[model samples]
Target chain A: MKENYYQPEIECASVETLKALQDERLVKQVKHVYENVPYYRDLMDKKGVKPEDIKSTADLHKLPFITKADLRDAYPYGLLAKPLDECVRIQSTSGTTGRRVVAFYTQHDVDLWEDCCARAIMAVGGTKEDVCQVSYGYGLFTGGPGLNGGSHKVGCLTLPMSSGNTERQLQFMTDLGATILCCTPSYAAYLGESLHEKGYTPETIPLKAGIFGAEPWTEEMRRDIEKSLGIKAYDIYGLTEISGPGVSFECSEQSGMHINEDHFIAEIINPETGEVLPEGEVGELVFTSLTKEAFPLLRYRTRDLCVLKREKCSCGRTLIKMSKPLGRSDDMMIIRGVNVFPSQIEAVLLNEGYTPNYRIEVDRVNNTDTFDVYVELSPEMFSDTVREITDRENKLAAAMRTMLGIGPKMHLVAPKTIARSEGKAVRVVDKRKLH
Target chain B: MSVKQISVFIENQPGKLAEATRYIAGHGINLRAMSIADTKDFGILRVICDDPEQSAEVLREGGYITNVTEVLAVGINDAPGSLATILEIIAKAGVSVEYTYAFLGTRMEGAFMIFRVDDNAKAAAALEAAGIKTVEQSDMF
Candidate 1:
């Protein structure tokens, strides 16, 4: 068997060599941002700093932190390092909260992004002979095009199937003999359910591996997807602002996502104080584009909470490894002074063998946030008696109490009772009636 | 006589019917007669109730995930060949019946058969033109 394409680069590169490469790229990136992007220059000047004053990665801390609100304030192209005419492509955020923050990419930037994604694919033992099915949607949304370009660059036959229309996607997967699949983790679960509904087995499609990302998913979800699809699932992390879907990826070992530190610098910092945190501790993830020319962000706060490890991975990659993201800093719900994340609830539900179709109803009852978890029983578990249903609901409540440290009222609903989102799942429904 | 019937997609598990009934009673809708067609994965709960529209609304409000489908409630004599006559009329109209069940009318003088046909409007029209008493939404309950 041929060795993995990324193995040699990861195994052979020394710590000294990797640091030297990062230092050179950091200097060049700082100079380029100061000269080309007015936003960086203005922010740096306000802090009494010049591009030449910064020397190494340690000096990067003196710079002001860039928040998502800053990106929103700048709007579409105010932060681009290059003019719009020179840009080759652009990708936009979902804009679920506010205005969409668009990221521009020049031709060289696009090539580098594709190269990183190709390296990621190769880390999972993907070969040129493999057929990759890109189901992440092709539009201004970055995922579909990013994976499609990378798969093509890796010399694989790429299928840009995009998202939705599950039946048609399955038909193509079977007929095309796709070997590698890429999409959000939630969609993979839905596809698995669709396959079961259609009476198809795992052998029906020729899928050996899957790269799931675009939303925060738990380890339980990973196992569920792997078991349902009968394929090894790897997590890929990226934001459109930095580079599409190839900022970092997990190797076949599945320990942590290996960051391409040569192109992008990863840091974990205290989200509240903007103070840098020690490695191996969970904090907000921040990234700076070292090689991107079109839109090289300087210390962009990703709002995702995760820990980083600089020790070499078993895959032999000198690149830094980041633990799977826990949750978004902004999306955390404080219920009765207890911080709760929907992902935590999802993990508990999966472990209890319940389908992950649940809605968290938080209502202000008697001046307190009362939580009601409306969970839908699987079609196979539904029965004709109320006693059996309440018994199952009690079991779910017990599991939630043990896992979440607090148990809310549980309601057993029929299958498909909860509304399904075509994109991201709506996890929180706060009915506090805030005026 | 005609009866108002509602067809809902129910999962094959315990307590689902009781929950549905609780929701219906909470909304003050009376259950007249009901039958369930069960398969391995799903069960179709066909009900002839006093107020079907309100009953469906209550089920939906309680988050039952059901769909309201129009089914024909034909008055069949409690004798042999009565259902055959209605099926023959429906077949002649090029309508295919998916599944069906029988229910006792309110007065107990006759039997009413609920037919879940592919084309509800066409089948109802054919049965009415053939002089069979086709139940309407208002005539049910």
Candidate 2:
């Protein structure tokens, strides 16, 4: 949390200098994409814009916005700006949403990506003396390898303990004295619960900090994990389309994640009209990779709805900071004329002292939307009478109703009744889709 | 005196009950009496066993949400009116019974029933005052 913990030269760069650097990179990257990637060049032609028109960040709006749909249309090689021989690695999305997006990275691109991640690790006080354990899924999934490379760049002793094999994760974590952990937020919470079940307290573990991301997690969930694991939990943000797990990271301030503006340019746009929005407005987050060679996405729409902040941070980083995503614009579920994100339900539960492991079941019966939440009770909360338990359910329903602006029927089931996941937890069951 | 009863939370799925019982059986524990309270979405499996501590630990280790509760077990005559008589006595004493389950006692001539009440000592006193024999942990095992 100290002011000069990380690379102060880049993180604390002046706004004037950062903007000038971005202006230079924007001009070169625009021409590079137009000359090499035919798919993007065609998109630019359709917009009646040329690479010369985008001379700086001011003219960035003139370029056509690229989306995941474009990535899918192009498929594997359509977006590559460099030759296949020049690229050293390719990381793909899980294809859970649709077609997997494979991003090619040249050795230069990989080095820059790892440098960004190294800055993140350094921001969290990770040093060479620390043993960093990377628990994100490895291989085609970008989480593990991205952080693994980043931890190495930071000069920390790295433990490439890819996800699962949680028992062994704990063993190595304790045996080797891992001081930093990199994994998804849900997996961090799962590790906390597993440690508690094994009768290990925070003092028994040597982890001092954890960088959790790859999925949207609430601030309340962050606090819960921090308390359970007895360490500071930091949020790291990235997507396969942009880079990997280190596009931005939280400093000791923990207010928001500082975007690596030197390598990527971020903008907010109205998702419907595709018109750019001014700073501080909540809209779709779009990023243009300025330094990536093989796969440089120009104004790629991230689909994550959040606000961008330019206010000077306490950490002294002038880089633009982004709030944790509210929810993906597409993942926002509409039930009974109300917009509900699973995260709102999670925040409500964690505030009410329940674990974040829950299922939101939305159904429609006879033209009416049925919203029910199945919550797994902790062991302490499971022994009450039926009336007492029902009363608690009603209280939770009222709390969620107040937060979500709609009432959802709440069921407090026994502990572990709902499934526990080792990966991204499935939290919603929309039965209306079946009908 | 009260007896130790282990209650586990189980989903109302097809194999949940079998899974829980098999887990306890695998630990070599014998159940003295067992009952399940069912709801549309889930069920609570309550059991009295030869070793309640071990039973709870085994079920918890098997990933079941288990709790140990104190309940008053009363031995009554093996007649139709025996349960009704005890229920009325406890009702008059103002001790509300949250749930109750009965099984044949170790003795052939009578039956043993368990009552999960708000206050175990109060329920035991009320049942004993009415000449009903409230069983102890020793009586069950």
Q: How well does candidate 1 score on lDDT at residue A224?
A: 79
State the lDDT at A115 in candidate 1: 87
What's the C-alpha lDDT at position A46 in model 2? 93
True contacts kept of 1: 0.15
* CA shift of A9, model 2, Å: 1.8
lDDT by residue for model 2 (A286-331), tens: 9999999999999999888889999978878899999988766665
lDDT of 1 at A395: 90
Model 1 chain A is weakest, by summed lDDT over 10 consecutive residues, at A379-388
Candidate 2 per-residue lDDT over residues B23-114, each given as its tens digit = 88888998878899887767888888877887788788888888899998887776678788888988888889899998776744577888
> The CA-based lDDT of model 2 is what?
0.85
Off by over 4 Å in 2: A4-6, A96-98, A332-435, B1-141
Global local distance difference test of model 1: 0.78
- Give DockQ per model, in order: 0.10, 0.31
Candidate 2 versus the native: TM-score? Answer: 0.61
lDDT string for model 1 (A1-435, tens) is 233764455434787877787778888888998998788788999998888777888788877777767788777777888888999898876332325678899999999899888987888778889999899878877789999889988899998899878888888888888888998877888887787788878877778899988765567778878888888899998888899888999986798898888788889999888899999988999998899999899899988899999786666677788988776678655453234567767777888788889999886543345788877776445443344456777898888766564587887666776899999888789775432
